[model samples]
Target: MSKYWSEAIQSLTPYVPGEQPKGSNIIKLNTNENPFPPSPMVLEAIHQFDTDRLRLYPDPDASALKLSLAEHFNVKANQVFVGNGSDEVLAHTFMAFFRQPQPLLMPDISYSFYDVYCNLYGIEAKHIPLQDNFCIVLDDYAQANGGIIFANPNAPTGRALTLEKIEALLQRNTETVVVVDEAYVDFGAQTAINLVDKYPNLLVIQTLSKSRSLAGMRVGFAIGSAELIEGLERVKNSFNSYPLDMLAQATAIAAIKDNDYFVETTQQIITMREWTNQQLQSLGFKIIPSKTNFVFASHRYIEAAELMGFLRTNQILVRHFSRPGINNHLRITIGTEAEMQAMIDCLKRHPDIISL
Candidate 1:
């Protein structure tokens, strides 16, 4: 409310990220972070970073890291764009391609950041409602506007839109850009990156945070036609030439190149997710069919708020949204087997209040 603040800054509503509680013993499943440690190669890369090289400015374009990503995804270096994180990549995408005469369309319940980005960029947003089961219905989006973007394994609900459906949307919305935020794709969803070669307007954004277990490193990227990447580069160059530092560049390349580690960790998470879903259901929680790394569920008998509080008291934290319609559901991240066991044990000890 200060007069000195600019209108944009004053009016802006920032996105709230998940809590990263500071402690050694907290069983943190609140944020959808990978429970496994990153590969030893990534650690070695960071540990071996040269202090003397810190004085020199990092490559403004992050060429080496781009090359590694290009090779990993089998795309041309020019077709990919790197950023501080997927959020930054998304921010650039909204500014460069999404802003237009017609409003951008997204799922009503989505990565909360989408609305914040719309507000920040002053782009009008039309939130299309999900189906009764919380799945994205492609037919409703046919009368769309400027652009379309949504997570593949749609967030919160953890339901995924198939690659075939994604292709259908791109075919219809040829003129407008279609961004697929694939932050959780590696968990189960098939990537739309396979379609980028055919559809020039299709842009797929991904992050090293979830699958690669590099959330601490803050590296994310987008794959599309060269022209789309150029638009993001223009926005990035206009803002910060060196969005990625030297150590981040080195570590990111290492993370992407460690194929064995990436496969093992993601597969483990997927297995754990299936186990968790079965366990939760056995305890009377109606779990959403999830293809992502987390599960969204609500117990038939217990109140969502009360369950969340009980979990917190037991020091097992999971995400509980305060937003309408989803207030009763909890978004629980799939941690290690032992962590899941501990959570189950805690739940077993508690009474079924709704039954009482």
Candidate 2:
């Protein structure tokens, strides 16, 4: 460690993102990225952008992008807040709402970034364990907490909570803020955006990266009551006046306007996810019932780490978490039909997998 490093910097166990392979021929499935290209409308928006304005800074507030998002979600302009990515919005959220006297409550096996953020901000966190089947138990969250946040169609596990369960939590736990990270909501999950108007404390965060296929554009937004949005804005402007760039703003607008394409692509993912689940089950892998674009599964006999290594050798990349209780499971992203078949074929040829 460098002597100049501050105590806080030295202590932080930074979040480790999924590996991005250097080769082009690799079937990259570790990160939950959309298999299809972005909408044609989004491409046209980029082509038509006025490049001469590169010298000028983009809209600091991202007003137009916010307007498009508001229209898409049926909310007003002030109710939306845009950022560089959902991760950035999540960072601002931790600073604005999660830092408090009471401990922040979240699932034990959740998006690892939540724990990283809590440690980064010096917030106390209480982890509620998921049920044996890797399902988040909501009743565990009702006791007391400074704040609560979880991914809808949750990451890694890909299990989701319904609107009814979310509202029930809201009805009783009204004292503190509640954040629903809906990064994969478009894939076979209901949104909590409608409940935002009824529950002032609820905030819904979403990204164009998943369904709209704009991960490269780096656009994410939060929908909440005007007051909560204002709070996020205060934190954002204090840290960085402009988080979204000019191109990002334009890309997000076009992606939002093309609702038909978004629907078609997400439906395709949902369909593929179920198909992959069946394929994996046929090979004796116990798969979780996933509503997201990825499926989490563990083989009945083969070790996940060994399988991951074998797949990596075959130029196929899938995510395997070594965390306690889930060390044997692999989180595989749903790719195109051809890519999925290639993966299945590769697995079928595995010597050990073939024996089973």
TM-score of every candidate: 0.98, 0.99
Segments of candidate 1 deviating more than 4 angstroms: 353-356
lDDT of 1 at 154: 91
C-alpha lDDT (0 to 100) for residue 238 of candidate 1: 97
RMSD of 1: 1.2
Candidate 2 residue runs with Cα over 4 Å from true position: none
- Expressed as tens digits, the lDDT of each residue in 167-253 for candidate 2 is 999998888999999999889889999999999999999998888899898988899999899999999999999889899999889
Q: After superposition, how far is residue 223 of candidate 2 from its true place, in Å?
A: 0.5
Q: Which residue pairs in model 2 clash with each other?
A: none
Candidate 1, position 145, lDDT:
89
Candidate 1's residue-wise lDDT over 135-178, tens digit each?
A: 99877889858999898889989999898999888888888999
lDDT of 2: 0.92
